[model samples]
Target: MTAELEARIELAQAVERGASVLSSRVVEAFLNVPRHPFVPAFYRRDGAKYVPTRGHNDAWLRAVYADDVLVTEVGGVHVEDAPDCGVTGVATSSSTAPGLMAEMLDALDVRPADRVWEIGTGTGYNAALLCHLAGAATVTTVDRTARLVDAAQGRLHEVGFAPAVLRADGAGTPPAGGPFDRIIATCAVRRVPTAWLEQCVTGGVIVAPIGNALGGGAVVHLTKLPDGGGGGGGGGDGPIH
Candidate 1:
């Protein structure tokens, strides 16, 4: 078997063991959507500096599918732009661990045609999974960073998915769109946004990490009710790290 496929299969097994119970569809999505395409390069901390890792070698491919968070941006600079000697900064964005991603996606309960709105487009890996679960045309993902949005859009398009990728604040109102069937946030928020609630259709699901959920290290999966109340269920505490 090819190295990528082998690594991904191993990752799938690890995710099933470490994260929440995944459905057949979720498993298929994990196996089908290769993580390396979305994260062309990532940072690995070497002492105080963050070194960039990029290549198509065996070790590189293994790390990409290792169920680990790949830090793509550090202090607003993409890893690809960093020097060989590396840079020192706080990680601004990353391709989250596959286990955490699987857990959240399983909680999202995406259907074939469900209209999905994703809060953080990060490496666009999660967005690609959403496209695999739902349809590409049914997904809309937004991120505040312009460069990240552009990179994500290009990577996603390269992989044959063309969801609506926007460079807008996830917490703010975008141009009239959605009464969406599902909304998922890959980023941490202090509280669930009122705009997100308003945009979701009644009975729609919102899977997000908010407030002490992360301190408790968990994600909340809420269903919108006709009365505009949410019926929440807790997903596994699969931390991004």
Candidate 2:
């Protein structure tokens, strides 16, 4: 690795260490998935270092390893295809930054062999991380964009990791996937979808960013109570910070 690359890695390690809310499995997943593959070529230079003329490669990598959210696509458009050099328009999808992801996972509390579902496949980066923690077969992810879904599928398979990926609306509930142990969304939702609450197992956790735009959003965590079917199950607080 180049000195810059080494520095980048060290930075990621430090962020992971400081992220007390993140779990070890989540940290490992952040370290394991290659953020370079999910990023556009312009943003990539030394594979691990950042190039400002290209994009914030180091910050993106740090976000990935920190389990935070990084916008990769916007307004149903992929970053590579967009004319703008840096992020532009509305962020429709992203490879969630590592720190935020870990925080979500730690809060969701997914365990080994637990069946988990993720909304917003994005670049499939988050799905890959989930597979690393929950096992490939135990994870299922859905995305609204067919192109994004296809691309994410290819990336995951290319890296020798596979999880059930589907093309679907982010707001819609998956088809009887299960009373999932945990459910997460890579995109922000204005409000918790009722369909998602129905699909979750009683007492299961559902995590997602609640609000519009990137800044001033709250990562809400909800627990499905035993009597959740009667509207008694869904209750939680927001802005995980």
Candidate 3:
């Protein structure tokens, strides 16, 4: 088998082992949608500085497939723009750990016809996976910065995904497409965005990391109520866990 294929298989297995839901669809998404194309270059912390690393070589490709979070930006500086000497700053954006992504995606329970709205389209890797789960044309992803939106759009197109990559604050209005079936946030928020809730369908799911703290605490699986309530919904709805 090819090295990239082997690496992706290893990644799929690793993510599968850690994920709470043993979803064959999620595993297939990992194996089919490559992580390297989304992150051509990323930052790896070395001492006090974050070093820029390119994904042109075999080792880098393997690292890309690894279940670790790859920091693609530091203090708004994309890895490709960073100096060779490196720089130290807070990670502004990153491609999340595959295991966590798998867990969250499983919680989202995206189906083929589901209209998904994704918050924080960093590197567009998650968006691509969403496309695999749902459909590319049906997925809409937004990011805070224009740079992220533009870059993510380019990379997504490179890998054959053409989701609606928009430049907007995820906390603000829900973007053009409304009444989304599934709304997911990649970043932690202080509280559920009212606009996000406004846009989601009555029985639709909203999965997000609910925490104001640094790394986030828990992921909440909320279903929109018929009365437009925050917590509970529908007769046969499951509890948010």
Candidate 4:
């Protein structure tokens, strides 16, 4: 096998071993989904500036397979569109680390026929993984930034998975897709959006990272109760253990 593929397999196995109870489907998705295509170029913070991976060289490939978050956009500028000198600003979007993704997917407990609505499309990696678990037709991902959404759509298509990728605000009303069986957000939200609750079917699952003013965060796994309210528990300041 090629070195890159070997590295990817090792990374997937490491993630699987680290998880307490990751489903087999989740493990397969992690092993097969190509993370490099989704994040063609990412930034490495060098002091005040962000440095882009020069090319798809050995270093870039190693970083792609690493169990680490990759910053793809900073200060509204995507790494692919940034100047050669690099950009300076807060990171606006990123590819979530594989370990965290596996935890959230485990919490979601996605089934084969489940219809999932993903809030943040970012690199499209998570959406692709969802498509792998739940058929592509049942997966829909939305992002507020048109550029990011468009790029993600193209990348997903390149990977032969074409789920519904839309450009809309995830915090607002859910997309016109309909009541979904699962709703997940890669971005941090201050509170669970009521629209998300309203869009999810009874007994559906919603997994998201909720942020607090104290700079702490938690991954909340809420189930839509019969009364259309959320009920469940959450893990604080770390991956759901």
Candidate 5:
């Protein structure tokens, strides 16, 4: 294999070895999904290297595999697009970095046959991973951008994985296929959306980033109370362990 490819493999392996600290399902998803495919050519031109706007490139690649989060885009623009400007577009969405995703999954504690609702389905990478764990038929993802929704849906289909993907604002609860066992938001929210709480099943989990400012990347893990109408909130801090 090429050096970059080899390095990526090693990175993935490292993440797998650390799975004891991560959710088993999340680790499996990282090993199964190819980050290279989702990364843009600008940052990934060197194969496995994750060259950021500034900083040590090698350190970034390792971070990608670790349980830490990586910002693939700023605003609506891919980081590679205008690295020098450091300007953010609108903060669309991303497949939460491998490390953060693991913690989120660990917090959710999804089980087989669990029906999942994934909001802000950016590239569909996260949805694909969830499907791999919960079964594609049990996963449904939504995005506000039609382009994003279509692209994610197409990618899932191309990979022979089928998950319900739709173009809709994630501000409200998903109507069909919910009363979900788990709900994950790939984007950020300032306040808990009552609609989301309303649709989650009793004892279900809702994992999302509760913030509006950049760099406020804390992942919030909420478990629905027995009534399925309320939740207790906690900041997720399970390291890239």
Candidate 6:
């Protein structure tokens, strides 16, 4: 096998070990999904600027296989579009850390027949994993940015996944595919959207990172109840992370 492929496998195994992801399905998804294609270019902070990887070589391969989060966009400027010197601004989006992603997916507890709605189609990486766990036809992913949605759709297709990728406000309108058996948000939200609760089947799981005003957050796993209320582990108040 190529060294890069070996590195990716090792990284997946390391993430599984570090995150304690017990589900074989989750582990297999992590091992199989190619993270590099989703993040063709990412920013590496250098001083006050965010520099893009020089080229897709060994260094880039090493970075992609790493378990760390890679910033794919800064201030709405995608890394591929940024100047050589790099862009400076808040990170508007990123590929979440592999360990954290595995944790959240484990919490999601996806099943083969489960229909899933993923909110934050950043790199299409998480959505790809969801497609691996469930079937691609059973997964629907949405993002607010049209550019991101378009790019993610193409990349997902390249990876033999063609889940329903849409450009819409995930917290607002419910996509036609629901009521989903599982709903996951890669982005943070201050409050759980009522639409999510409405779109999810009763007893379905909603896993997301919830932040608080204290600058702290935790990944929460909530279950939709028969009365339309949500109850699960962890509690915090802030935007979804």
lDDT of 1 by residue, 1-241 (tens): 9878888888878888885457889888988887888877889989999999988998889889997778887887889888888989788777778887887888889999999999888888889999999999999999888888898899899889999999899888842459899999888777778888889999999988764432235688889989887888775553232
What is the per-residue lDDT of model 5 for residues 9-38, given as tens digits with 9 covering 90 to 100?
Answer: 665566666556766566666666655434
- Candidate 6 vs. true structure, TM-score: 0.94
Can you write out model 6's per-residue Cα lDDT over 44-93, one digit (the tens) per residue? Answer: 99999998875779888888888787888888898878999898988777
| Candidate 6 RMSD computed on C-alpha atoms after optimal superposition onto the true structure | 2.5
Weakest 10 consecutive residues, lDDT, candidate 5? 40-49
Alpha-carbon lDDT, every model: 0.83, 0.66, 0.83, 0.85, 0.66, 0.84
- lDDT string for model 4 (82-156, tens) is 888898988777776788889899889999979999988888899999999998998999989888889989999
How does each model score on TM-score?
0.93, 0.77, 0.92, 0.94, 0.75, 0.94
Q: What TM-score does structure 3 among the candidates reach? A: 0.92
Give the RMSD in angstroms, all C-alphas superposed, for model 5. 5.6
lDDT of 2 by residue, 23-102 (tens): 66666665665665665433222233322223556654444344344555555566667553344445455554455556
Pick out the ten consecutive residues of candidate 6 with the lowest summed lDDT: 232-241
Off by over 4 Å in 3: 232-241
Backbone clash tally (model 3): 0
Best by lDDT: 4
Off by over 4 Å in 2: 1-12, 42-69, 83-91, 229-241
Residue pairs in clash, model 1? 214-217
Task: List clash counts for every candidate, in order.
Answer: 1, 14, 0, 0, 5, 8
